[model samples]
Target: MMKRLKSRLSSIVIAICLPVIVVADPIVGVWKTEPDRKSLISHIKITACGDKFCGRILSAYDASGKEVQTPNIGKKLFWDVVGEGGGKYGGGEFWVPLINVDAVPQMTLQGDKLLVKGCEHAICAHQTWSRL
Candidate 1:
């Protein structure tokens, strides 16, 4: 009887902890950014950088869908992004190299699309990016 009870307890423990071990944050993947002013798009890879969520530009392309060969490739576009769970992420800043613009961003995820809103004091901008 004791051996059977121990087996049942172990089974219950595994059942409770298995999901926590196997589950991953939904936003941890590559995402395609919306087109910029010059109609160029960027591929941003979202990953856990240090203790926070960060996205880096893996590549860039122009309106023709051709690779633009810019220095922005492999650049960290946003950092210090904290995922507060429940499809919400914030506490990050957007860094644009070309226009030299930076703003704090708040993000929400819906299905495979990420909606991000950036605000710098009174000015604000929004973009929706798709998962790649």
Candidate 2:
């Protein structure tokens, strides 16, 4: 019957479009990084870059929560990050501005908090950032 054929076609269309409709990753947003040693915090914006993800510094604030000028603004902090589902992401390069080094980074997202860990050679560090 034509009705049965149409119903089958509708089901196929919905199945094909469902994944595209829900493809927005939860990690795509602005996140507030933990204060550095100097007590300066930065806001990083994460967005899709190609098939991966990247984050860049959007703004910086002093310990008093006052916006400050920084030379690192608009710099890419992380790139080539791939989401591995289940709130896990890895396969990215993280830049350490303090030491001017690049490291492998792994990130985990839990609710409004993101834990970023990076290691270069024998040195390793981790920081927790919050969603802003």
Candidate 3:
């Protein structure tokens, strides 16, 4: 009877601890920025940079849909992501080297909308990103 009780207790402990062991999905995939008719171009790609999450230009095209080469390829797009509890990330700036603007970019994934908080140099463009 004591052995059977011990087995049941072990099973209960494992069941209780299983949820804590499950980790959230890592945000290391292609993401597309929300399109804008006013802006000439828009694109986004969230990639893993060391231990941080960084974004890059995945696609930039003119109105004709032709691929355009972006100037900010190797720049640091974002950082300080691990502190935001996995899905929420911030503490970095997003910039376009061709354009003269760098915004304090904070992003959170909710459903299919990646809400981005943009604020830098008096220019803010709140963009919603979609996973690609």
Give me the candidate number with maximum lDDT.
2
Which model is ahead, 2 or 3, in terms of lDDT?
Answer: 2
What would the per-residue lDDT of candidate 3 be over residues 17-63, giving only the tens digit for each residue? 65333323345566666555534355666665545567766566676
Per-residue CA lDDT of model 1 for 9-121, tens digit only, reads 99999877754432367887898888988798999998876557888999999988999888888888898888777899999788866667988978999999999888888
- lDDT (CA) for every model shown? 0.84, 0.90, 0.63
* Residues 18-77 of candidate 2: C-alpha lDDT, one tens digit per residue: 544334788889999999877999999998776688999999999999999888999999
Best-to-worst order by lDDT is 2, 1, 3
Question: TM-score of the candidate numbered 1?
Answer: 0.79
**Backbone clashes in model 2:** 0
Best by TM-score: 2
Off by over 4 Å in 3: 1-26, 36-38, 73-76, 96-99, 121-123
Indicate the worst ten consecutive residues by lDDT in candidate 2: 15-24
- Report the poorest 10 consecutive residues by lDDT, candidate 1: 16-25
RMSD of each: 5.6, 4.8, 7.3
Off by over 4 Å in 1: 1-23
TM-score of each: 0.79, 0.82, 0.61
**Number of clashes recorded per candidate:** 0, 0, 0
Looking at model 3, residue 79 earns an lDDT score of: 54
